[model samples]
Target: MADGAGRRVDPDVDLRVPRDRREVAAHPAAVLGAIAAGGVLGALARAGLQAAFPHGPATFAWATFGVNVSGCLLIGVLMAVLRAAGGGPPLARPFLGVGVLGGFTTFSTYAVDVHAALVAGAPATALAYLAATVVGALFAVWAGDTLTGRLLSRGAR
Candidate 1:
């Protein structure tokens, strides 16, 4: 098959799925198990933190905010580390990034916090939190990735 760019595409290859056999094989039980295990650990950690630092309506959901931002940072670190290590194991990204960080970051809770704040007649607080979380998360990811990359390069030197 020829793509729009006139590049020859393999007729047997499914564009939606991974082109690599190893990746395809890795998608079944082992990968799932890794994600499940990582998710369980991440969820537990998030839950523990939330429990320890409970918040109420009209107040900052500091625990959830911290968890999400930290998780994003860790995701960046994990990606940098993986890239430095030539992508590491196949399961690494899925387990650590997708599973662990995905589980750890609570978007639902963040939404609820915003809703609760607004319902409590704290629109300013809600808006502030909403903006802060987004900015904080982006900054965290960028900082983590960049810092880890620099550190790794220094070590290599």
Candidate 2:
């Protein structure tokens, strides 16, 4: 990266652009509405944290991370719960997890959060948070799947 003296920054530096940023981000209004519902919930949750957190420039943003992680965890567990209960069904899985949380916990938001941290020059924290969120979320999903599988199997038995 360039210094205060205006040295050239490396163009090869990694940036977090969504895998299919343009296509995914640019949807028609109705499609956006489905996604937006979850985003509203996530954004509101983030906003409501100001009173409780009341610290850090990005404490509000931590809410988004939490929502993303929690939603992933919940989806894994809930899917199993539904399968075990066999209560017919409700919302489609894609509508809730992919459409909702996917829209809610935006790669764009995470990328911007990271970018903000990076530009503010807290590269260490940004990288650490990035790695933790990505890796931790993956592990959490696996764990959730395992836990749910056990719970469903228990019901089967």
TM-scores, each model vs. reference: 0.83, 0.60
Q: Which ten residues in a row have the lowest lDDT in candidate 2?
A: 5-14
- For each candidate, the alpha-carbon lDDT, in order, equals 0.78, 0.54
| Residue 134 lDDT (model 2) | 88
Candidate 1 lDDT by residue in tens digits, 1-157: 1212112132112244242235547467876787788889899999999999998899898999999999989977887786677656777866887678888998999998999999999999899899999999999988998999999989999
Q: What overall lDDT, based on C-alpha atoms, would model 2 receive against the true structure?
A: 0.54
User: CA shift at 139, candidate 2, in angstroms?
Assistant: 1.5
Model 2 collision count: 0
* RMSD to native, candidate 2: 13.4
Shift of residue 24 alpha carbon in model 1, Å:
4.6
Clashing pairs counted in every model: 0, 0
Report the Cα RMSD per candidate. Answer: 6.7, 13.4
| Model 1 per-residue lDDT at 26 | 48
